[model samples]
Target: MKEYYPPPTPHEHDIEKMSNRITNARIEELEKLKERKDELKEKIKEKKDKMKEIRDAMERGDTADMILSSSAAALNKRGKETSNLTNEDLLEIQEMAIERLEEQFSKVEEELKQLKDMESS
Candidate 1:
């Protein structure tokens, strides 16, 4: 085995190596998260299609970018209240639909939670 020694002062390369390792790890986690989000979006699409098909089978119908602007308009402190919402929020988000909305809401909420955790860490 080869023994490694630190220089009198560890060089930029060592610091860079550590930073690079952390960055690579974060990127890998982000990639996995993106992949998961994609999968969930696909599943959501499939469910929405199924909902449409159900409606179509019943009534014969078929069918749909978005941004918020202005920093001046803001409200509420963001601790647990804003960024982290509750089960009631989940319920309200799904209040309009039958079972499908609830299912999708749960999935979406879970995904949001995971992303939030990643961001926090």
Candidate 2:
């Protein structure tokens, strides 16, 4: 004879539904975090590329004598010589800024790892 089983109680069904919702929410959160991490990586790469361009320009001595009007080149003096700041000094400042961006990228990487661990558990 087959064994008889009772259907799940109302409370058990509610609990199961809630658990599924929580799992879905966690998955969504993880996806968003991963996306953010990717964006940060891209930003860092772009910054590095820009830094290289700045270095090349500095070496040519062209960028030092004039400033580009674009917001990105806003720091340039537009042919007005800064008494105290050299191209080398400006390059150093750019390096410092890149270092800060790298720090932020590292933090995002760490956060993504933590979220992955949580998802796995």
Candidate 3:
């Protein structure tokens, strides 16, 4: 014949303390996530604002004027500056700026989705 042993039970106080600790940890995690989300939102807003500024500058013909007014040495980093900038250069810069902003927006959106999934889990 084999003797049977009873399972050990946790004390009520210990159980309650453990539950509280878990809850507090979860709450802290949520708060940190929310804070990060807010920060990301702010960054997105700033990027959008910059994109708008760039668009507005292009629309007002300010970009061309500014480039034309500045010395080639001042505008070009390579020191092999051309006497005149082509429309293509301006368009390319604008396109690159827009693409960068879009990339940032997408990355933040993905992060937000992951955070939501974590919260649900």
TM-score of each: 0.42, 0.73, 0.50
TM-score of 1: 0.42
lDDT of 1 by residue, 55-95 (tens): 44435321100011111123232222223433334334334
Once model 1 is optimally superposed onto the true structure by TM-score, how far is the C-alpha of residue 37 displaced, in angstroms? 1.2
Name the candidate, 2 or 3, with the larger lDDT value: 2
TM-score of structure candidate 2? 0.73
lDDT of 2 by residue, 1-121 (tens): 9999899999999999999999898788878878877887787788777668777777777554342325335434365434455567666766887788778878877887887798788
- Model with the higher TM-score, candidate 1 or 2: 2
Ranking by TM-score: 2, 3, 1
The predicted structure with the larger lDDT, 1 or 3, is 3
Q: How much RMSD separates candidate 3 from the native structure?
A: 8.0
The models' CA-based lDDT, in order, is 0.52, 0.72, 0.64
Collision count of model 2: 0
Top-scoring candidate (lDDT): 2
Candidate 2 positional error at 118, Å: 2.1
Off by over 4 Å in 2: 65-86
